[model samples]
Each structure stands twice: as structure tokens, then as C-alpha cells.
Target: MDFDKLRESCRKISMPPEMKSRIKTNCKAANADEKQRSRTDGRLVAVCVCCILLLLGIGLTYSGIFERKLPAASDRADASKAENENKFAEILSTAKLTADRIFETTRANIDETEMSSKTQTQSQQSTESTVPEQTTEFVTNPFVFPNGEHAANTGSDDLSYVRPLYLEMSNRENLIIAKEAAETMSQEDFDLFLAENQSMLQGGYFHSMNAGEYLEFTQREWYIPVAPEDMAEICWMYYEPTHEKIDLGMDFSETSKIRFDINETYKADYYYKDSNKYRYEKTIQRDNATIKIYSRRWLYRFENFAWKGYRMDITVCGQEMSAITTEMPLEELEKYLEMIDFVTIKDWLS
Candidate 1:
């Protein structure tokens, strides 16, 4: 049949209304029944899964698969002990800090007390020091000092403690007097003597080790290098009152122009402004002895007078000696030092 004819034939083919309704009702009821059956099956599967999981969990529990080993009693005790020790250490640390603080406080108090005591002692000492000590008079050189008091001769060192006591007792005006007194010498005679007898003279100050002129105070007046009672260079001062040359080191002094102690062991230096005015220092080995040479370009004070020059120091025969003079040339000074009888003096010392 043709498509148009076939389509007309299909349109004529209609179902009964009751039969179509019955078919639709049957389809809806079947869909509802299928949905109900699906819901019941899902509920049954869920219940079966829950029962299987519960049984599996119980079986695992009975087989001991999830069991853990219990810690030993000793381990538990150790843990408890460690905790107690930690707490005890913490308490001890706190106590230590408290003790440290107490110690520091006590130490500070002790320091304050010591400081107070020291201050009181110092104050008392200062007050006592302000008061003058009693001074005795000089019997021999009474007229020399203003207060008729002179320093006691402590040793063989020249002017040991003399200049300081003079300075202490004397005023500035007396410094000028000191300068004048120091310079009261026959310069012409000194020059002539240095020129002539310098090489001949030895043994510090004595001319020939001959003891002369028995003076009071167990001192013999021997050959003096320079003259006129007030002047001194190398001097032989002390001797037995018997005019006996019993020992070589009766008393000897070596004075020079520049300021330095012989060995600088004694405070005999005429004070100078500074050591900063130094020129140079030198060392020389001569006659089995070390000679130290110190030269300064600045002035040195002899009482109030200022002088400057070269200084040479040497220790020989257990005696400190030096020569510092512009009065004589270096060559002459060296010769003068060389001529000193240190070898014989060493024997005397022995």
C-alpha cells in the first residue's frame, strides 16, 4: 500500500477508551510494584551488611587482633619517679635562686660595712698625718738649715734623705741660697785640678788611700777632688776617728752635673721636670762591666738652679757610680771613669 493510504488506514485503527485506560493503569501499577520491591531489597541488603560487619568485629575481638601489650609495673613506677624528680629539681632550683639572692644581699651588706670601716680608718689616719712629727736639731750642721734640723745620714749614699728634709723645712727663698751655696767653689782651681790630677786620682775620692785629718764623728778628712769646704765632687768623707784606713769603703760620694742616682738606688737626684727631655740611651761594655749612658737635652734642677748634660751610670765592685759633666769632654770623662780603681775596690769589698 502507498504511504498516504497506509497513514489513513492507521488513523482509522483506534483502541477502545476503556481498553486504553486499562492498559495505562496496568503500566502505572507495575511501576509502583517494581519501586516497592526495589525498596524492600535495599532494606534487606542493608540489614545483611550490618549483621556481617557486626560479626566480623566480634570475630576480630575474640582472635585478639586488636590487643596491645600492657606496660610492666617497673615502667609505670619509673615514669612516676621521673615526674617526682622533675618536681623536686624544680623546687631545688627555686630554693637555689632564693639562696643566691640571700648570699648576694649578705655580701653587699658586708662590703658596705668594710667600706665604712675603711673610710673611718682613712679619715682618722688623715687627721693624724696632718699633725707634724717632732724634729731633732742638727749638732754639726746646725747653722746650715733654717730650723737647725738636718736629715740623719742613713747610708753612704750622698745626700740621702737630706734634700727632701731641706725642701720640707726650707722656703723658696732658701732654694736660691742652696743654689748659691752649691756653686761656692773655685772654678779655676777645679778646672786646673781636673786637667792635672784626674788621671792620677782613683779609688772613688781618696788621693792615695792615705787617711788624713782625724775629724769628729769617726770621720777622717781625706783628699777632696774639689776645694773650699762647701764644694764636693768625688769626696772621701768617713774614716775611723783614729785616722786609720781600716776599710776602703769608709764613706765615698760621686757627684755629677746631670741628675741621676749612681745605681739610682737612693733618692739623691736633684729633681728635674721630666724624663721626657731625654736625648738617648746607650750601653757599653768596658773592663768587664756594663756602662749605661743616658743623655738628656733638657735642664735638671739642683735646688733652684737648672743644668743639662750627658749622664753615664755604672755598677762596679758593688758600688753605683756615674759621671755626668759638661765641664769635661766625653774623652776626658771616659778617662776619668777608667782611672777609678774598681779592681782594687772589688778586692776591698771581698
Candidate 2:
């Protein structure tokens, strides 16, 4: 692009050796003829050189015009980026404003909930000894499968957290029939029912095992059948305190998680010191409906008292519902199974 350098390069240009030799031979022959012809020959030579210079200048100009006409790749990319921004800027701004509003609303609700919880706790502390509510989310291997739900209050601390899945029905009629059938059994009949089924407590209550170092899911929270309203709650998963390793979301990929999600066969391996009681699998008939159970029982001790605990996963046939019960009255669960008999009284349930 420097004009001075370009002009210098052009000045250095010379005719080819062969062409200069031929031109020199013609000029010598013309000089021998006459001065007029010699001057004419000189002018002819000048015209040839001028034409060569003109052609060279024309070629350089053609190339320079093309080079200036075409845009660069980076220039094209920047133009495309600007066009996209112009098209979506308003839409993006609107979306950001909506997202900020939603976030603020969620934060406000969480703060309000915390305030309510604090007030309730203070009132409880004023009355009697209180087991502080733990809001921390915990997960572990095998039996303590996460329901993928965070409940603000799992349930009453001193009682079982297993709620009948039938109560989860949206229809008012479904709620009434399920609750009534569950409550219909009188205290005597319920005790009789427990005796009939193996619902009686296997171990003592309030007894702490030697394994106090382990965390038990039943002590704080419990698991129940997780399914849609159309499906029955059959399988329950809960953790019992044992001397075994507690895998709290550690080495997840290496650990083969126990999954008995809805509709999957409930066959899984567990361990225990006792070979016989390591696992129990059976199919029993209740209310003329077949029920499959996968269970393991263990005994824990504190001082002289012995507490019996079981990690039982019961699947009610045909209804697709399951439950896991421990340290609580199993009769309450039995009443549930008998109440929601889908095989014989399908119409009644429907």
C-alpha cells in the first residue's frame, strides 16, 4: 500500500535480455539508413516500453480493487453477532425480569416458613423437652432410598411417619372409605388382628442398641410407598441401626444402589451376622389377596431391655402398593391392607 515503495519497484523493472538484444539489432540497422528513420525507430521503442508499463499498472490495479471489495471472515462474524443481539435483546430482558421476580417470591416464602417454625419451636420448648426438628436432607445406600421429596415436617417425632397411601386420594369419597375401613377395626379386633398376622412387636421399645454410632432412618424420618394416586403403595424402605458401614452419598458410582421402584421385582441382597435371619422372603394371603414380603429382622439391646427391629418391604398384590414398618404397631398397616383390598372388592374400592 506504500506508493513510494511501489514506484521504486517499478523503476527497477527492465526489458528481458533477448528482447533488448533484438531491439538493439533493429536500431543499428535503422541508424545506417537515415537520421529521420532512426528518430522514428527511437520513438517506436519508447512506445513499446510505455505499453509494457501500462499493462503492469493495469494488472496491479485490478488485484487491488478485488482485495478491497471482499470483506474479511472476522468482519462477517461480528455482523452476524450484532444482528442476533438486536433480534433477541427485548425477549431476553423480559425473561430475566420474570426469573428475578420468581426468585424473590421463593426466598420470601422460605423466610416466612422459617419464622413460623421458630415460633412453634419456642412454644414447644416452653412446655417440655423437645426433640429439635432437623431440616437437613440425608440419603444413604440400599434401604434408605430417597423419595426425592423434601417434607418440611416428616411427622410427629414420637410416632410412626407412615401415612396410608389411600389417604392421598384426591376424590373425597376415596378418602372417606379408606379412613373408615382403617378405623373400623376396634381396639380388640385390632389386637386380635395383630395376633393373627405377625403384627405384634418383635422387640422391645425405647431400647438402644450397642450400635449407637450408626444413624437410623426410623428415629427421625421414615419411607413409604412412592407412587401416583392410581398406584398402590406396596414397598417400603427404611434404615435400621446396624454395625455396618453407613454410606451417606459417598462412593456413589461404586456402590450398587438398591432400587425397588414401582413395578420392579423386589429381590435384593442384604447382610447380617445370622444366616437364617439375614433375609426373609414370603408370600402370604391377606383378605384373600396374595401379598409378597421381603424382610430382615434384627435385635438391639440397651442395659437389660432388648428391642426388636425389622427392615421389611411388603408389596400388596394387584394394588401395586407397598409399606415398610418398624418400632410401631403393624396392625395399623394390616388394617390398611385389608381396607384397600382391590382383588375381591374392586368395585367397593373403585
Candidate 3:
């Protein structure tokens, strides 16, 4: 009943052939199913491994850690802040460029404006400089005298229209010279005689005395009588010939008065040792035309007394028509001025 007996018994026990073949077939089918399942499980595991690797690669690229290690929260915040700083710097650069452009544009505009203004000013100045100055024209008129006597209008071309009175005065003998000579001779010779016999000097007039024994002497010989009207005309012609009339176009009215100080007007021409000795003044007015008059006074000191002299100037309108200097009083000088025919002169000026 040992091993030999058990082996013999198992060999002697036989089954049907068809049943054994069926069991073998079932075993074969089961082995084939297990191999296919094992192959499917291995393919699934490989596919899962490939998907996981792909997911890891995508995560690293998106998170910006493909080139470096993943950062912590603080490191990520620092990186983001640095990026923001770079963006801010770029924005500031763009803003600065824009400001520079604006400044350049504004400067160019200002420069253009200044240049234009300067050009306008220079043009105006040039135009003003190119303009010409106005000139006055002078014309001559027929000469007339205050006296009723008119100068003969000679047909000769050599004759001047205006006859100067100075020529006539020069041709005649000077009465002042003869009178001076007589006074000087009386003073030299008969001074004591005249002082003792005051009644012998017929008239107090210096010219009345006989200066010396002359071949011929007559009262009318020393006298060249000139009427007041003729004398005024002569004086006027002497100072200013009728041909030389000034048209200064001065504005005047009946009541208007103009006074000129000779000291101020002719500072360089007048000089005197004594400040109070010599003075000259002029006044002017108009009715239909201007009438100007001036008075000059001078005082001279002698051994015991002071001698005073006066001069008068007359003008019809603005023309210097007459002037006279004498030892006459102010009232007498005024009388001479009043004798002038101003209305006639005003008509001539017009």
C-alpha cells in the first residue's frame, strides 16, 4: 500500500478520451485569456505614464519654470514686482520722448514768432527812413515903404525892386557927426567962458553954438529934415529890405501875448561886466497879423553919474522891420513906436 501500490492503482484507473481532450481545450483557452489581459494591463500602465509626463511638461511651460526651478510665493511676488518695475520704466521712457517732442515744437513756434516780430519792426523802420523830409519855399514880393512917397520903378534891369534906405542915409552928411564935433570943440575951447556967461549960449542945445570960424554957415545947412513917416520907413528899410520877408507862420490872436527874455534867447551873444547893467526884452501880439516889439536898456557909469540909453525894435508880423537906439526916455520911445502905421504894414504882410 505504499508508493508502488498507489502508482499501479492510478495507472489502472483510465478515463474517456473525449473527456480528457475537452479538459485540455478548456485549460488552453483559459491560458490564452490570461495572457491577453496581462498585455492590456501593461499597455494601460504605459499610456498613463506618457500622459503624466505630458501634463508635467505643459504645467512647467505655463508656470514659467521650464528653464528654472519652481519658485516659492515670496520669490514669485518678487519676480512679478520686478516685471512691473520694468514696465513702469518703459512707460516713463515713452512719456519723456513725448515731452521732448512737445518742447521742441513749442520752442520752434516761439522762435518763429520772435523772428516775425523783428522782421516787422525792421521793415517799419526801413520804410520810415526812406521817407523824404518836407522843405519850405521862399518867394519875394514888391517892396513898399511907410511913407506915401514910392520908389520910382525904373525900366533898367540893373535896378533892384527895393531901394535900401541905408544907401540914402549914407549919401547924406551925418548930423550926429557935425553935432559931436561942435560939442567937442566947445568943451575944449570955450568951456570956462560958457560956464561964466550962461546967457551967451543962446539955446541949451549943443548944436546951436558956433564951433569955429567957417567960410559958410547956415541953419538949414546942418539940418536934413526928415518927416516922422519917412523916418519910420527909412528905419524899416535900413534894418530889413522889403524883399526879405519871413513867413514863420506863427499863431497869434488879438489878446494873445508873447514875451521873450533876451538873456535866455541870445545867451552867447550878450555878455556884460555888471549883471544889472544891460537887459533886453521883446513882446508880441496880433490884431489881423502879428506885431512884435522889443526894448533894450543899458547903463554906463561915469566919474560921478550914470548914463542910461534905450533901444527900440519893431517888427510887422515876424519880420524885423525897424530898430533905433537913443538916449530917449521910455515914454518918448513908446511915442515913436505909436507913430508907426501898423495897419498899413499888416495889410502889406497879408
Q: Candidate 1 lDDT (Cα, whole model)?
A: 0.36
- What TM-score, computed on C-alpha atoms, does each candidate reach? 0.19, 0.21, 0.19
Q: Which stretches in model 3 have alpha-carbon errors above 4 Å?
A: 1-16, 35-350
Clashing pairs in 3: none
User: Candidate 1 lDDT, tens digit per residue, 1-350?
Assistant: 49999899899989999999999999999999999999999999999999999999999999878877657868965765555455435534544553354335435544554455445445656776432221111111111222333211221222222211000112223323322332453433332332232222211221112223221111111132221111222223232333322221223222221111111111121112333543346666556555555442321212111112334445564455433323234454355444434443233223
lDDT of 2: 0.34
Candidate 3, residues 194-306: lDDT per residue as tens digits? 22222112111111212221212121112112212222222111112233322111211111111111112111111233335333444434443343332222211100001
TM-score of 2: 0.21
Off by over 4 Å in 1: 68-350
How far is each candidate from the true structure, as Cα RMSD in Å?
A: 36.8, 28.8, 48.1
Worst 10 residues of 3 by lDDT: 134-143
Q: Which ten residues in a row are the worst by lDDT in model 2? A: 198-207
Angstrom error of the Cα, residue 38, model 2: value is 60
Q: lDDT of each structure?
A: 0.36, 0.34, 0.34
Candidate 2 at residue 318, lDDT?
Answer: 52
